[model samples]
Each structure stands twice: as structure tokens, then as C-alpha cells.
Target: MKRIISQCSKELSQFKRDRLTLALAFLLPLITLFIFGFAIRLEAKNIPLVIQDYDRSPISQRYVAKLFATNQFIFVPWSVNDSVEIALDRAIAKAGIIIPPEFSRRIAAGNIADVQVLVDGTDSNNARVIKNSIKATTNDFMQSEGLIPETNLLTTRSRLWFNPARQESLYIVPGVYAVVLWIFPSLLSAIAMVREKERQTILQVYASSMTSTELILGKGLAYLIVSLGIALVVMGIGAIVFRLSFAGDPTPLLVAIPIYLWASVMFGTMLGTRTTNQNAAVQGVALVGFLTALLLSGFIYPLSNIPFPLSLLPNVIPARYFIEITRDAYVRGTGWIGVWFAELMIFAIGMFFFNVARRVLSKMQLTE
Candidate 1:
């Protein structure tokens, strides 16, 4: 026990001695939380909208005013000064409302008329939301002005829930935590362990009575604790500084964290054994981390949106489950019942990799 404790202390001391790794250990998670939380918001609000009103009539003016009055549209322009197509092409605006030259003249004549709306389809999600908001806004204006069809049609309206304000931060913050934590812990551990092997430190331990399992466990555990501390700090900054709301209970997040940390350390161990230099280790971590985060994280394109076979890919990505567990606890506020399967999977993967680590390290020949 004393020897293991000494080994752990020495490992941690070695970790602290490296300024870059130490700074990354503390700073990376916080930086990821802030960047992903603010940048990748789920809800589309205040999208830039342009109006090309050619009619110059009271009814058209009223329509324009009503559209701008809604908080949804950031009305950047209110004239047909620039072409609608050009505005969209230049990405200056998302949606364009073009009122016909005879809009008010026809309204005065009690003739039913329609306006042409041009929406930029660059971002499908943004396009969808802006189109929906504009449609609702227009429909409401028509109803208020009694512009109803003589043939009545039944209509249904559905309200979006949970993220009532449609704030992107709500959806993003939880996922950000999962991706950043997943990458940092595994990358750090992989490099750290490999560095020990390169320095002949693993040989020194093996020369003593320490088993390969003990060496791996000691190294993995120390990194896991460090990861937990970093997770807490990242969560704190997200909740306090960025004003991200964690709606769910924290018990599931607490429970699932160590499981994730374990899996990460095991993965790091696997990578560490494969790489030759610190550069190779860092590169391996970055490549795997970015690719896994992009494909498996379910932050950019949702798992449901992907094809059936591709959805299975997320299961292999540890961060995907971590995101699920984090969202269940923080957003839905659920307990073990909500995320038991994810917790189990992480544990199973961790154990599987640990076994592999034991085998690999036992066979590994290190020199003094």
C-alpha cells in the first residue's frame, strides 16, 4: 500500500512538473465548455432577416412593422435597396420578405394576394426555424386583419417544450462537458503512461514486486482522480460563469463520471502502449479525440438523423454515452433508472480494456 501510494505520488508529481500538460489539464476543459456552450447553441433565435418592400403602401408597411416587431427577426434592412437573391448569396441575411408592387393596392381593392419569401437554405436547421417563425408571424397578422379563406381548414399548433426559450446553451453545455472530458483524460493518461515507459520507470516498477495490473491500476486511478477534479471545475465554470442551467439532479452525473474516467484511462493505456514518442501519443490522442467527438458525440448531427448502421457507431464512442448520461442527469434530472445501461456499458468497456492492458503490459519488455 505504501509503495503504491508512493508510486501514485511520484506519478502526480511528474504530471505537475510539466507546465503545458498541467495547464491543459486545468484549462482545456474550461475552454471547451465555453467555446462549445456558446457557439453550438441548439435554438435559432434573432436570425438576421431582410425585407424588400416594393409596394410602399400602408398595408405593406404594417406587415413589415409587425414582422420586425417580433423579437425573432433582427431586421437589418427594410427596403428593396439590395436584391433578395444577392442578400442571401452574400449571407448577409437568412430570410427575405419581398412585398409585391401591387400589395397595398390589391389589399385596398379587397383582393387576396401573396408575397414571395426567399429563405437561405445554407443552414438547414436555421432555415427551418426562421421559416416556421415567419410563417407563424404572417399567419397571426392575417388572422388579426381578417384575411381568412372562405373555405375553412382545420389547423393544429404544437408548442415546443423543455428548452422553452430555445437557448442553445441548454443543449450544448451538457454535450460539451462530455466531449472535452472524454478527450482530455484519455489523451493525458495515454501520454503520461507512455512517457513513463520511455523513461524506464515501468521497468523499475516491474523489477520490484509490482504486477502489471497494479502498475496500470495505480496510473489509471491517479489520472481518473485528476479527471474528476477537472470535470468539477469545468462544470463549475459552466454553471456559475456562463450561466448554464443544469436542470436535472447531479447524482447520475456524479456516478457516471468515474465510469467514464476509467474507460478513458484504459483507452489511454492502450494508445500509450502503441505509440513511440510523446509527439506520436499526442497526435494519436488528437486524431482519435477529434474524429470520435465529431462522429460519435451527437452534438453536430444527432444520432437519430444518421442512418441506422451509423447510429451504432456512437455506442463505441465513450463520449456519446457520457453525453447521454450528463443530459439525463443535468437536463432531465433523472437518477440511475435513466442511465443504467450507459453506466453498465462504460464499466464493461473499462474492464475489457483493463484486461487487455494487463496482457499487453505483462508481455512488454522494458530496459533500465
Candidate 2:
């Protein structure tokens, strides 16, 4: 016990002495949280809309007013001589509405009036939202003006579950926590071990009376505690800055975080043993662990949306499972029954990596 404590103390002291590592351990998570939180928003607002009204009628003006009433679009003035294509080409407007000549006359005669809508498809997501808003606004105008009967052909109401307001921050903040834990703990541990190897200090440990198991535990435990503190800081930032809510029981999340951190530390330790230098260790952790978590861990995209063999790839990514566990605990508020399987999977993976790293250390000790 004394030897393990000494090892833990030694690693902590080393971490404190290294200014770069200490900054990364504490500041990286906060920086990542702020960047992703403020920058990546899904909701579309204030889309630029240009109108070419050839009709110049009261009805045409009313239609334009109704569309702008939704606050989803801002009207950009267009003259009859100005071309719609020019506005789109110059990026002055995302969409253009053209009310053809005799529009009010055609409506009065009970004949279909043609309206042309030109949309810039460069950003498909924003274009889709703008199209839907226009459709809803037109429908409301038709109903209010007695152009359409009050009785609808099909009336539909949607009830959103879990996140009723559908705020992007609600979905993103929890995933950011997964990303922070995935990157920092692994990077810190990998650099620590590789630095020791580079300095030839690992030889002293190999010759010491302390077993390989104690060495691994002592080093891992220290980082694990530091990582947990980082996680709490991230969660607090999310709650305070983004107004993220913990809707469900937080027990599963509390339990799963350390388990994920264990897997991360062991994975880093294994990479450290394979690499010859701290640079290689950092590169390996970033390419193998951080990028995998960022892209494939169901963070930015849905697993179901990704097809066949690609969808199956996330099964091997530990962050995918941790992200699921986090969402279940913080967003859905599920109990152990909901998250036990994911928790077990993380534990199994952690144990596998931990044992592999222990074996490598044991071999190193024997050979030295």
C-alpha cells in the first residue's frame, strides 16, 4: 500500500511540474466545451428572402407580410428589373419568391395561380428549414384569407419526446463531456508514460520491489481522480452556461464516467508502451482515440443514419457506448436497468486493456 501511494504521489508530482501537461489536463476540456457549445447550432433563423412581385396587388403584399411574420425570414427588397439569379449568385438571398402577373385575378376567378420559388441548395439543411417555414406560412395565409376552407384535409400535430423544444445545446452538451474525457485522460496518460520511458526513469521502477500491477494501479488511479474532477468541471459549465438539464437519475452517469476513464487510461498506457517517444504517443492517442470518438462515436451523426458496415464500426468504439450511457442518464433519466449493459461493456473493455498493459509491464520488468 505504501509503495502504491508513493508511485501515485510520484506521478502527481511529475504532472504538476510539467506546465504544458497541467494546462492540457485542466484547460482543454473547458476550451472544447465553449467552442462546440457556442459554434455548432442546428436551428435555422433569419434566412434572407427576396420577393419579385410582378402582380403589385394587395394580395401579393399580404402574402409577403404573412411569410415575414414567422420571423424565420428577412425580406430583401427586389425590383422588377433585378434578376432572381443575380441575387442568388451574389449570395444576397437564400430564397426568392416570385408572384406572377394576374395572381389576384386568377384567384378571384377560381383558377390556380402560379408562384415560383427559387432556393439556394448550397446548404441543404438550412434550405430545407426555409422551405418548410414558407409552406407553413402560405398555408396559414390561405386559411385566413378564405382562399382555403377552414376544415383541413389532414390535420397533424407533433409531440416531441424527451426534448420538446429541440434545442441543439441539449443534445450537444452531454456528448461534449464524452469527448473531453476521451481525449484528455488518454493524452495525459500516454504523455506521462512516454516521458518516463524517454527519460530512462522507467528502468528504476522495473528494478524496484513494486509489482507491475501496483505501478499500473497507482498511476491510473491518480489520473482517474484528476479526470473525474475535469468531468465535474465540464458538467458544471454545461449546466451553468448552456442551461443543460439533468432530467433523469445521474447515478448511471456517475458510475460510467470512471469506467470510461479507466478504459481511456489503459488504452493510453498500451500506446505508450508501443511508441518510442512522447510525440508518437500524442499522435497515436489523437488519431486512434480522439478522432474516432469525434467522428464515429455517434456524437455528430446518428448511428441509424449511417449505413451497413459503417454502422457496425461504432460497436468497437468505446466512446459510442459512453455517449449512449451519458444521454441515457442525463437526458432520458434512465436507471441502472437502462444503462447496465453499456456499463458492463465499458468495464469489460477496460479490464481487457488493463490486463494487456499489465502483461507488457511485467515483460518489461522481467527483461530489465
Candidate 3:
């Protein structure tokens, strides 16, 4: 115990002695939090929609106003001489609408009329959002103005539960915690362990009285403390800037954070041992730790949406589970019952990392 503590102290001293590493440990997570918190939006808005109104009637004008009423879209003014096709070709707007001269006449006659809609499908998601927004807006306009067929219809009312305001930060910031925590701690520790190899100090440590377990524990413990500090600062800043507040029991996150962090640092330690140089270790962390946490961990894309064979990968991702804990803590507040399995999975993954590192280190103890 004393030896492990001493080793931890030694690692911490070395970690702080280097100014760059110290700055990276603290500053990087803050930068990532702000960037992701402000930049990523699940719900797209401010879409530029070009309108070519040939009718110029009051009803057609009202319909255009209704589209912009939700503030999801902004109208792009095109000159009378310019065609909607030209505006779309120039990439001036995401979508274009052609309101024909017969638009109001058809509605007045209670006849079906088709208004041409051309959407730029360069980004399928954005195009889909614009299409849906326009459809919903048009439906609302017809219903409010009593232009409907007046047939009985099935109506379902939707209440935006948990996040009524549809603030993207509420959903985005919690997942950002998972990605930032998973990346930096693992990154810092990977570089540190690889640096020991580059200096040939690991060989001396292996030959010393301190067993492989102590060294691993000490290094893990040191980086774990650094990981905690990173967590506190990153999460604190997320709360202040995003206006995030816990919606339910904070206990699930309190329990899951350390376990998740253990998985992160241990993952770094594993990468350090596998790679011969700091460069390889850094690449390994970025490719495995950063990519998996950012993409496969249900941060931006839903795990179910990830194509088959690839979808199975999220099962083992520690960040995937930690995201559940964090989002639950802030949004759902389902408590321990909601996230107990995620906590267990994170711990299991951490132990798996520790075991793998231990086996690797034990073999290396012979200095092979």
C-alpha cells in the first residue's frame, strides 16, 4: 500500500513537472466542452428556403408566412428574373418552393393542387428535416384556415416530455462529458506510460522491488486523480455554460463516473504497453479511445442506427454506458435502477483493462 502510494506520488510529481502535459490535462477538456456544447445541434434550424411565388395571392402569402412562423426556416429573396432552379443550382438555399398561379384558385374550388418543392439532397438529414418542416407547416396552415376536406381524422397529440423546450444543449452536453472524459485521461496516461518506455525507465522499474502490480496501480491511481480533476472542471463548466441542472437523483452519475474513468485510464495504460513509442501510443488512443467514444458511444448517432456488425461494437464501449448514466442523471433521473447495468458494465470493462495490463506486465517482469 505504501509503495503504491509512493509510486502514485512519484507519477503525479512527474506529470506536473512537465508544463505541456499539465496544461493538456486541464485545458483540453474545457475547450472540447465549449466547442461541442455550442456547436452540435440535434434539431436543425435557420434553414435557408428560397420562395418563388407566381400567384402573389393573399393565401399564398399567408402560406409562406406560416412556414417561417416556427423559425425553423428563413426565406431567401430571389429576383423576379432569377428562377428557383437557378437559386437552387447556385446553392443559395437548402430548399425552394414554387407557388403556382393556381394555388389559391385550387384551394378556393376545394380541388387538390400541387405546389412544386425542390430540395437539395446533398445532406440527407438536412433535406429530410426541411421536407418535414415544410409538410408540417403547410398542414397547419390548411387546418387553421379551414381548407381541409372536413373528414373525420385520427389525431394524436404529442407532448415534448423531459425536454419541453427542445434545447439541444441539454441532450448534447451530457454526451460531450463521456467523449471528453474518455479521450483526455486515456490520452494523457498513454503518453506518460509510453514516455517511460522511450526513456528506458520501465526496464529499471521492472527490475526493482516494486512488482508490476504496484507500478500499474500507482500509474493508474495518479492518472485517475488527474482524471477526476478533469471531470470536475469539465462538468462544472458544462453546468454553468449550458444551464444544465440535474433532473433526477444524482447518485447514478456519482457512482458511475469513477468506474467509467477507471476504464478510460486503464485503456490508456493498455495502449501504452502495446505501443513502442509515444507517437504510436497517441495514435492508438485517438483511433481506439477517441473514435469509439465519439462515434459508437451514442453521442451523436443512435447505437441502433449504426449498421449491423458495427452496431455490436457499442456493447463493449465504456463511453456508451457512461453516456446513459450522465443523460439519466441530468435528463431522465431514472436513479440506480435505470443505470445499474451501465455502472456494472463500466466496472467490468475497467477490470478487463486492468487484467489485460496485469497479464502483459507480469510477462514483461521477466524483461522479455
Question: lDDT: which candidate is best?
Answer: 3
**Weakest 10 consecutive residues, lDDT, candidate 3?**
147-156
Best by TM-score: 3
For each candidate in the order shown, give its overall lDDT on alpha carbons.
0.80, 0.86, 0.90
Stretches of candidate 2 exceeding 4 Å from the true structure: none
Superposed by TM-score, candidate 2 places the C-alpha of residue 147 at a distance from the truth, in angstroms, of: 2.8
Tens digit per residue, CA lDDT, model 2, 339-362? 888888888888888898889889
All candidates' TM-scores? 0.90, 0.92, 0.97
Clashes within 3 Å, all models in order: 5, 1, 0
How many angstroms is residue 247 displaced in model 1 relative to the true structure, after the best TM-score fit? 3.3
Report lDDT (Cα) of residue 209, candidate 1. Answer: 82
Instruction: Please identify which of the two predictions, 1 or 3, would achieve the higher TM-score against the true structure.
Output: 3
**Residue-wise lDDT of candidate 3 within 236-296, one digit each (tens)?**
9889988999998998898888888889999999988888998899899989888999999
